[model samples]
Target: MIRKWAMRAVIAYFLFGTAMYVYLFFIADTAIPQMYKGTSADPATFLNARELMLSEEYSNIRNLLFFLNKPYQWLFYYLILLFGISAAFERWAKKTSKWFSLQTLIYLFWLSLASFIVTFPFAYTSYLFSKTYQISTQVFSSWMRDQLIDFWVGYATMAVVVLVIYMMMRKYKKRWWLAVWVLSIPFSIFMMFIQPVVIDPLYNDFYPLQNKQLETKILSLADEADIPAEHVYEVDMSTKTNALNAYVTGVGSNSRIVLWDTTLERLDDEEVLFIMAHEMGHYVEKHIYKGIAGYILLTFAGLWITAKLMDLWVNKRGKIWKVEGTANISSLPAFLLITSVLLFAASPLTNWVSRYQETRADQYALEMTEDPAAGVRTFQDLTRAGLSQVNPPYLVKIFRYGHPTMLERINMAEEFKQQVSEE
Candidate 1:
């Protein structure tokens, strides 16, 4: 009777969470659009507005790429339901004369390998689309090499995660979730600190900014904002893609600003300065630290929720699924499937948190630079260079976008101009 009640509670928990998320998504989708949808700062007001005009061929290609991935997302779920990568890996690992940890290592290795193989078609299709649109300039050999590197990186990361999970399971079976959540904080920070120095360099070359004049200007801007001003890095992205981007990465001593060569080549000095100021704004606002804090909180919450859901699910379906426990290894795909479902259902809410931070960063950038016109021009450059949809459909914005739409950002710049004029 108690188990039955627990099951009912889990179901209720999921349903209530889903309903709440849907309601919030609806609210954001409806309310936020009216603020900027047809405003004067709408990208339509700017020439080369990506959303306003496109050749039919380009439009068809863009729309096809946009919608093609929706169904492909289910490939992960379907593979779990059908071929069962986790089950196969677990069963195969157990066939060896290995200890439990060894079995887990082997299981993880195979799972990662299987994941890469299973998803390569989707990756290839996406790559093809990027190539078609002149976004990706990478040669096939280079792309394949990157793919292999990515596989190993994923395998290493997951190995640590799975090993820690099982270690906690063995050490503190009753409340291992709490322990895992605690450990994740430091691990996440360590990743953030090392990512710029360690992980990113594995794929791209990064050199100190060669443009002495622009570097001086950027350092001046950073100094004004009380940020670290040395060591601006330029990534050799033109060798890989035509997309323009700049970002602040790492934390503390490892923090660095990296700009793509394409961005430097494509945008003029004023526009580039506006973009750099935006990146600086992220640091000045302590967004990196805030992001870590958010991750820490989400870590505990996600692990706790997963623990309950996994326990309930395994209890109900363990025998049928040929899985003994949460740490059984065969149960991994089920865990992944459940967590993916939870995340997918909750994406709008999560994305809203990211959008809020991005919007804050935009406002801060405007204030720090005091160049509303330049800010507006930066977005215009962004649209043409990145081919970003000016106003993505509401559903896409709610679920997929981590930043506010182009129109929303341009509107922010316009509002800044108005406020400054009034002052």
Candidate 2:
């Protein structure tokens, strides 16, 4: 009987997985193309106003995503409630009910605390595991405290907002998706306005670039490439791991370059110039807006399909586990699961586009710097400084890495150097 029940459970999980894909593909094959058609309805009249027109399309896409996310969020919560109940039952069945009961007692105590009403000890345990493996730089206590604070802030903010939205939708009984889309547009605009200014500062300290010589060199490269930026800032990355990174943050007047302090401390002036030039290429090429535009185009279909699939999942099997989509609170786990599964599903499409984008940036970096050797040194130093795996398996890098592997990058830089030397 136990074995038979296990077989049934396995079958159910497989069916759920299949239903998710079929729903996504069916919706994506229809809704996305229609949205794109809507996107092209009124082409920008002037070249300069094209950005404005595209921005409108982007807003529409985000609005659609807001509606899509509601049902997806519901399914996500249902899945988590199912998992929690299953875990509790499994413990009870193993004659470990006493220990499980103790855990629940502790959770109840924590949940009752007014200040720290967020009880997500199991989620905190995952970060602890990461720290144990040296993958996460945060200490266990610090990680736990950060998680608790984050959970409370996010939970409180989202609870009030979601409740208001739900009540409004329920009371009016108009197309809730349409209402959600309307509400989401302004929220999206607010995010666009404040993410670089307000949100990034909450997580990391930012300071103006202090090294005059290095800063001057970077500025010169940007000037050469015709990338306009008023200032560069150094970010305190030493507080975390030794990974090297740099990016152009913000849009329009808020735009500025941010470099990880690790990059400055570890890389020489020339290599740093090359890295800056690469980042400047991103600006000159307008890759940031381009990236946002790409996501805006895709997210409409992605979220709608996600919502439809989650609804199907809830209808099919959620009740067996007493998991109601609308009432459950632990929805993030389901979102994470579906996201992971979809990432795997869309790996080929995403990977191809990513590799192409990286290649284009690399080409621009080579052209902008006029020194392929600097580019090579920059790549090598970054790899060494970060202790990167030099030759990851192709499948691993293809799916996991956004950038090319260390060896692939080094070889590309070397090829550019050879071609330049011959010229």
On lDDT, the candidate that comes out on top is 1
Best-performing candidate as measured by TM-score? 1
TM-score for each of the candidates: 0.85, 0.65
Clashes found in each candidate (C-alpha, N, C closer than 3 A): 0, 1
In angstroms, how far off is 148's CA in candidate 2?
A: 4.6
Q: What lDDT does the true structure give each of the candidates?
A: 0.76, 0.56
Tens-digit lDDT string for candidate 2 (88-171): 333333343345334333332232242232224334544544344333576566565666557555554444444444444445
After superposition, which runs of candidate 1 have C-alpha atoms over 4 Å from their true positions? Answer: 1-85
Candidate 1 C-alpha lDDT tens digits along 339-396: 6667777788879988998898888888888898988888877766666666665666
C-alpha displacement of 61 in model 1, angstroms?
6.8
